[model samples]
Target: MSSQQQEKYEESELYRIRHSAAHIMAQAVMEMFEPGEAQIAIGPPIEDGFYYDFDLPRPLTPEDLVAIEKRMRQIIAGQHKFEKKAVSAEEAKAMFADQPYKIELIEGLETGGVDEYGEPLDEKPEISFYSHDAFTDLCRGPHVEHTGKINPSAIKLLHIAGAYWRGDEKRPMLQRIYGTAWKNKDELEAHLGRLEEAKKRDHRRLGKELDLFSVSPDVGSGLILWHPKGALVRHLAEEFCKDEHLANGYDFVYSPHIGRGQLWEKSGHLKWYQENMYSPLDIEGNEYYLKPMNCPFHIEIFKSRVRSYRDLPMRFAEWGTVYRYERSGVLHGLMRVRGFTQDDAHLFCREDQMPEEIDRVLDFCLHLLRGFGMNEFKAYLSTRDPQKSAGDTQRWDDATEALRAALDRVGLDYEVDEGGAAFYGPKIDLKMIDALGREWQLSTIQFDFNLPERFELIYIGEDGERRQPYMIHRALLGSMERFMGVLIEHYGGAFPLWLAPVQAIVIPIADRHIPYAEEVAARMEAAGLRVEVDARGDRMNAKIRDAQNQKIPFMLVVGDHEVENNVVAPRLRSEERLDALRVEDLIGRMQKDIEDRM
Candidate 1:
């Protein structure tokens, strides 16, 4: 959003309504508990809704949420006018003496430090509190003028969960109540409907139901075990991507999984990224670490050979796997995994070639994503943070402009995230909107001034002098594991014909038809289709149901009639049945679907 748009939203009635709803929920919680029993913490309005944390005497239950919401409705009905008052630091501390969490916030405000929630206050400002009815708490005011302005039916208590104070494991866990407040009942209903749809498409549930992948206790958390079916889909995706990269002038390369500690030091990973890295192992007399990235090794490859300006644009691609330590609590299915393969590539180009190269790569990223059935895309340009970023000011400015120009040249809409760039360089991150309208960051094209300079990467120019080369890091699919997970959910496990592990299943009506089913499967397999034969001793309908459950694209049913006429009845996953067709016609149709990527 632009600054003007953001200002309009922050000043809108809906913003005030949500903010006040948070306070109302907090008030209801206090009334439910005995005085001093519920230590109120920070309650803030977030995107789309609000949440409040509390150090309560006990864990809240579903019944407790109902009661609290009921009390909030009553308070809203009372039409209490919100009142704000300024207070001195000493006075604020004394007023909230009974509330330990409030007292801590007050002290932090006074000292210009972080509060219990770890929200920083660079400088102490005037302390204030907002009150409505008999409830009062520490807060910054921009609330509704009166509770009557809020629609009671528009607010709902969503759910309850445990959250550690300040998001630190060492801190005490607090109960967090999440709620959504809308302007009216209709909007709330629409939001709830979307949530229901999202639940049905959740990747974790579909991953298990479709038997694509699993996280086993024996293999350790965040380490995914891709079953055979899942592996096949993944392999197809990789094959498609590799073919595209090769066609686009990328030279495929391979590197070891572990590297010497000095490699990371030269790459600056040790100083800036050690926290996410695992401890190094002592091999012989040297230290080796699991490679956390593929950039350093790619750089080593470039340095291994001296080249003139003719080799200025060197694009090296690899499906490199890396490991990083992710907290167990945050270990989601495939989204936040410890081990994964990145579709990583690096391009070494001259200064004059930077803009065109970036534009080409951006186009390639969009084309590749579209080929994977993801058509919606938007780019985010993250520029350097002055205080934290490395590299010279001129280089940073040039790189930022190059990224912006690439987006403009491609006629792509993008939002600029000022000061959000990594320490190394500016980047353009492409996000794909899934079927549920949820955005996933899938591709990133970054300029790396730090790495080239750190490694002293140079290329001989036409003038015979060695000049520094610009390095562009691009990851089109981001990671194979996460992209597969996204694909599974996006299609609800019903992949397109080309990507489906089992493109077709031949189901025999009776035991005597098994030979015919196998023959059909063999014919299909010979035509380059991944076909399976269901020879189990089950009824025809049961076999068809099992094939449907597996989400196979086509089910070719064969029996005495099919065997005699060289024809089979085809059933789609959508339960649409086609007229009996000759084997040659079926193959042609299936081939067309695969060619079209349907």
Candidate 2:
């Protein structure tokens, strides 16, 4: 097979194997626990693994995982044939009679194939079911021909946790079991290695170890309390972004945290995003809401004045804080949160300026990612879906074609997601791959035809007539909290010189060398470096170990020998290599690095 075909074949084979593994896992859980005690919901393949959500009588323990694995191995030995039979909606409903979630799914399939809790989709002609022996699921599936093709040893159940059905807190809470399956033992081992590496760099653990930030129980879930160290890092990140934006011709703008409900109605957010928003508060008999997005505020600023085409392609940026209600089950340490600041911007331009403006934004996005030492990226241009979105087909085609033209002009390759655009318009999303090969959505440039229409925003063209100007909503570092989480994992808590909370730690070789260490630290600080002197009376080895554990970028040892020479010993995070340098020379180098933001 050709390389492209080979990739497709491998993906197909892996999906079949992983999906089958999910079923076997569900069966294994059934065998271990009593019927009705453990109920299974949808189990599908994610990026690297499959997760099956279930509702069980008791929480699964580590011992339970061991027992469940044995049961899975026995089933794999049986090698039951997976018989996929297509059935009608009624038949599917009957087959899943005992499973309410499945029955709801069946009802949804019959009624335009929408999920139970989803907004309804337009009618489609055909929807079917797939069955594997006694376990029949309401899924539009393309499973493996049989379970015998799956390598049992390549599958391993990782952990168990809770997830809300359909990711809605109002829905039933279910147990989510995560597992990974690969085509061969070697691939499985590689995947396990990545997972282990990810665990080592998990931001939550690193946050505690480095004394950066915390999510205290008293502070509530999904909310971060940034300690001094974390705040310093965040402030530096914001300053860097601000400086870059200023240089790139972006005007800084700020808006209120709360806005009247009428503002959302004018922006159409009240119609589409009300569910994700907190309940409005009645302020003096008027409804007010915490701002869920900065687009409306930016639009208001644009509408504050009437302008000719001379002001075309105006860019306004804000580090605006927004609040959205997130389900507690999906609440992670900092990745998913209730409130966060977005590095948001809005670009207003004439129709003729779309292509160049998009190219400029793409270039800016690339630079921003590179500023954080990220280079590998995947770009996708998403167009509207006729069934889900509200827009004329002609407009969507024009917007999508415009985005494609922009990418082509910039010579940036991107995938086209045919039906993945927002209800308003098409968008180009950029996902950056971190050290662990995990992708994070760091930047997005989306066209907003709907918002301009809703807000009735217009500008006087060269023809002396008012015309609707195009709006682009862009967010680099989508959320400050989430981006910080990504940064922590990417750097393994060892940030580069520009981003480190404490760039250098001055350690005395012995108790008698404290004064010299303080002097060295003062000199570094005066040079605009974040420096700390370890005067804790700990042993040199212990201090070095602590610094290493915290992932400090540079450790400086000041001793009698070095003090007499007016020099300091430097150890970098890259290696165990050390060098002796004069204090002045070290300060100059450090200052240069900080200035370069390297």
Report clashes for each candidate as comma-separated counts: 0, 1
Residue-level lDDT of model 2, residues 458-517, one tens digit each, is: 999999999888889999888899889888887889888999998989989988888899
lDDT of 2 at 320: 96
**Best model number under lDDT:** 1
- What's model 1's TM-score? 0.87
What RMSD does model 2 have? 5.0
lDDT, candidate 1, 160-213, per-residue tens: 988887688798899999999999999999988888888777778778878888
- At residue 324, give the lDDT of candidate 1: 94
Residue 273 displacement (Å), model 2 = 2.0
